[model samples]
Every structure is written in structure tokens, then in C-alpha cells.
Target: MTFAAQVAMFSKLAEEKGMVNSLEGNLSVIDRQTGNIYITPSHRAKCLLTEEEICIVNPQGEQIGGTGKKSSEFFLHEAAYKARPDVGAVVHCHTPYLSAYAFAYRDFETPKDTFLSQIFGNIKCLPYGAHGTHEIHQGIEEALDGRPVALLGGHGVVCVGEDLEDAIGIMEAAENYAKTIAIKHKLF
Candidate 1:
């Protein structure tokens, strides 16, 4: 699939999952061969993002193409890409249930469900850092440590994968697992 289509698909998925409302989350894709990064723009609603709204940045974080301003969180994507050369795409979102766990400083244990286990592996919690700051980017990079997903304290979650679809699937699985855990906790 084209990069634009993947961006649109992820935007819609984020909206559908309520992970992002009005541009609260970001998605990025890296061209492994060329080191070009494509990402969603800041300030645009995720549900309404179009192909043109995506921004292209080089490995150095310089905008080379596309429309709109790159997300302030572009540094987070850059840091992750630099740390994990095997990762091709990253998805970051303020998923409520997961963020709740983060805000509470509770590590999200792997859910007992087989599907969740198979998909999410284990999600590690990272220290709190200022949003859009280099510190937060570094924190995420450290948290990755070869893991596919990491929960940012008092912030959100980041999922990295070999491509856009894999990244999105990880995010979706994490959120679903978090939601299920929240429901079960409420019941007990």
C-alpha cells in the first residue's frame, strides 16, 4: 500500500479506537532504503487527516515535502528510528486506559488472554518527561530496548513495528488489552 493510504488508514483507526481526538496522536513511517520519514501533521484532527496533510522529513528532521507542520513530537519518532534501525513505522497515542495505567505508575502486565499475549508481548513503562521535549524522546528510546511498545509515564503509548500496519495493530492490541483490564478491575 501507498504511504498516504497507510496514513489515512491509521488516522481512521486511531479515531475509531478513540486513541486520538483532534490530532492528539501521531503516526510516522520511515523509508528504510532512503531514510525519509513521513508523518501526520500537527493540529489536524486524526479523523479528518488527508494524504496531503502528511509531512515528510529527512533523517535529520528537516521537512522535505508534504503539507502542514510536522508534529512537535517528531523528535520522538526520530529518536525511536535512530535507536531501532529495524523499525519502519511508529504510532503514538493518548489511549485512555493505557494512559491511566501510566499516570498511576503501574506497569501494564501482559494480559492473560492468548490473543493479547501473542500480539503485545510485554509493554514497559518509561519515566515521565516533558511532552515534545528531547527528554521524552530519549525516554522512549530507552524504554523500547527491543520491545515493540512502551508506555510513557503521565503521557501516552508508543508502538513501533516493521511497517505502518504492524505498528497500528500493536497499538490497537495494547489499547484493547488495557480496556479489558480496566473493565475487569472495575468489576472486582
Candidate 2:
């Protein structure tokens, strides 16, 4: 599948799974060979995203292809790529369970022996960085130094992987892990 198509497919799946809402999330994958980034558009609903609507930006954040405007949070994705060359895709999700920790400014201190730890390895919540501004994405590289996921302080969650499938897998796993923790605290 094309890179744009892959992003659109995962964006819709993210919406269906409640990892992202109609207009609150973004997904992107880079063409490692060409350095082109296929990303979701700004102000559009992920549930209804189309491959044609996916925007393409060069490594320097210039619009190189596609018809739609790139997401405002593009810096966040750029930072991840710069920090981890091994990552090919990035997903920004506003998932409920995961956002709970972000909103509370708390980190996910998963036990080292747990399955979630294997996936997230203790998610960190970075300090508040206003969305759409450079400040918001600052320190992201350091936070993701050796982790696949991190909670955006007072914002949402960011997950990365070798591709869209891997990125979203980390995202879904993190959400489910967060949900389990919430339920455990409530009932126990």
C-alpha cells in the first residue's frame, strides 16, 4: 500500500477504536527512501479521512505533495523522527485512559515485569507544551530517548514505531494498559 493510504487506514482505525476522536488526533509515516512524510490533515475528521487528503511534507517540513494542509502538530512528529531514526511512523492519540494520565500530569510507572512495561517501558509525562507551538514538542526527543510512548503533559499521548501498524499497536496497548490501571484503582 502507498504511504498515504497506510496513514489514512490507521487514522480511521484509530477513530473506530476510540484512540482518536473526529478531529483530535494525527498520524504520519515517513518514506524512508524519499524522506517524504505522509501525514493526516489539519482540522479534518480521522473517521472520514481519505488517502487523497493526506499531506506530504519533506524532512524539513515543507509541503511536497498531496492536496491537504499538514497538521499543526507536525513539529511533534518531526521531533520524534529526529530523535529516533529507527521510527518510521508516529501516532498522536487522545485516547481516554491514556489522556487521564496526561491530564493529571502523571507518568505511567508500569512494573518492569508487566506486559505493558515491555511495550511502553514506563511512559513519561512531559511538562506542558502548548499545542501547535514549538514549545510543546520540546524535550520530546529526550523523553522518547529509549521509549516508544510518552504522555504529553496537559495534552494527550504520542507513540512511535517502525511503521503505522507498530505505532498504533503501541498506542492501543498503552490505552488498554492505562484502562486496566484505572479500573484496578477504582475497584480495589
The residue-by-residue lDDT of candidate 2 on 76-97, one tens digit each, is: 8888888889999999978888
Worst lDDT run of 10 residues, candidate 1, spans 137-146
Please report the candidate that would top TM-score against the real structure: 2
lDDT of 1 by residue, 24-120 (tens): 8899888888888888888888878888778989877799887878988998888888878888899898888888888986678885667777656
Off by over 4 Å in 1: 111-115
Q: Which candidate has the top score in lDDT?
A: 2
TM-score of each: 0.89, 0.95
Candidate 2: 10-residue stretch with minimal lDDT: 111-120
Cα lDDT of candidate 2 equals 0.87
Residue 141 alpha-carbon offset, candidate 2, angstroms: 1.9
